[model samples]
Target: FVFADVIGQIVELTPIEVVSANGKETHKLTVELRNEKDERLPMVLWGNFATDVSDAIQGRGENAIICVLRFGKIKVWKYERSVLNAYNVSDVELNPLTPEVEAFASLLSSVYIVMCTIAAIESDMGCYYLSCKVCSKKVLNVPNDNIDEQGDEDEMGFHYYCVKCKVKNPRLMPRYKLHLVVLDNPGNSKFLLFDAIAMQILNRPCNELTGSNFEEMQDPEDILLALKDLV
Candidate 1:
C-alpha cells in the first residue's frame, strides 16, 4: 500500500457535493493544500470524511487552518496525481502541534498584524450579509408557504436557508463583509474584512444597523461616519 503524509496550510476548500458513484449517492469534497515551498497539492475526501472536514471548518469559522493528513493513499486520474483517504486507516489533524507543523506554519504569512490608514471605504460593494446562526455561513432567503393563520409574515416575510447546514428557517445573524481601500508608506491596496475582523475594527455589531431586515443594504451615514474616523 502506497501511503504519504502531507502537512500544509489549507488554501482552498470547495463546497461538498453529492455524486452518483456506482448507482449510490455519496459525498465529495476537494481541498487544495499549499506546502512551505508554495507548491499546491489537491486532496479529495469521500463519504464521511468530506462531511467531517466541512463541519470542522464551519464550526471554527477560521479563515485559515493548518492540516496534517497521514497515511493517505496516492492516486492518479487523467495523469494528475492526488491524495485520498485510505478508508478507516487515514487520519486528519487540524492545527496540530508537531515539529513539522510548527516549521511549516512559520513560513506562512497569512497571519499578521499591520498598521494602516483608511484611505476610503468602498461603498459600491456594500457591507454586511445575513449569516446562519448555527454555522456562521452566508444564508439566503427562500419562498416559504408555511405561514401562520393570521397571515402575518415571518420575521422577514420569508424563511432563511443555509445550504451548508441544509436547514430551513434557521436562526440568522448579521455579519460584516465590507471592503476598504487602505494606504501606508509604500502604496495603497484594497482589503476585505470578514465578520470577526470587521467587528473588531468598527467596534460595533452589524445588527445595530440592520435590525430585522435581512436584505443587503448600504451602510448608513452614521456607519460611514464611524469609518471616516479611521481615516
Candidate 2:
C-alpha cells in the first residue's frame, strides 16, 4: 500500500459521476490536499478506492489531519507523476493535540467554565445573551417569526440580535469561527466560544435567577469565583 501523510480541511466533495469508456464504467474522485506548510495538491481516487470517498468526507471539517495512499503515473506537464489513484483514508484526527492544540484546549476549557458561570447567573436574572468574547458582543433574543425568506411558513425558527455589533446575526455560527478567551487565576488569559445549543444549555433558566429583575442580579464574577473554589 502506498502511504503518505496528508492533512487538510475537506474543501469540496464532487458528486459521484460515472462514465463509460471502452465498454467499461470508470469511477473517479477528485480531492484537494493542503499540508501544514500550506502546499496544495490534487489527488485522484479511482476504482475501488473511490467507494470510500463518502465516508472519508463525512464530518471531516476543514483543517483536519488525514492520511492518504498516493498512487500516480508520470506525466510531462508538471515534470512529476500525475496523481492517478488515491484512497484508504484512515486515521483521521481533528485538531491534532500538538503544543498549540494543548494550549488551545486549556484556554477553551477555562473560557467555557467562565461563560457557563455567567450564563448561570444571567439565567437566574431571567436574561439570556449569547456572549462572544472575541468580539465582546452580546447576542440578544428576538421573537420567533413563523416565516422564512421565501415567505414560507417556518414555525420552528427564531431570531437574535447583537447589541454590540448592531446587526442581526445567525443563531448558529460555525464552531471553528468561535473561540474562547481564558483568564486563569495566575493572570493568564485566552478566548473560546461554545456551539449554540451548548450555550443555551449552560444558561438554562433556573428558579434562582428566573423571573428576577436585572437590578436584583448579582455579580457573575462572584458566582464564578465561588464555583471555581468548589472545583
C-alpha lDDT values of all predictions: 0.76, 0.40
Candidate 2 per-residue C-alpha lDDT over 1-231 given as tens digits, one digit per residue, 9 for 90 to 100: 334544343333343334454688655656655544445566556665554564445445333434343334323355533344433443333456566545434433121124322212222332233433344333444555545454222343545544434566533221211122334555533223333333354453322333232222235433322223212
Q: Mind giving the per-residue lDDT tens digits that candidate 1 earns over 1-231?
A: 479997878866755666778898777888888887778789888888888887787676666798888999888879778898877999998888888888888898875576788887776677777778887766755655655534434545666677678898678898887778888889987777777778897788888756787667654543545556666
Model 2 is weakest, by summed lDDT over 10 consecutive residues, at 172-181
CA error at residue 126 for candidate 1, angstroms: 3.3
Deviation from native of the Cα of residue 43 in model 2, angstroms: 0.7
- Per-residue lDDT of 143 in model 2: 51
Top candidate, metric lDDT? 1
lDDT of predicted model 2: 0.40
lDDT of 2 at 222: 30
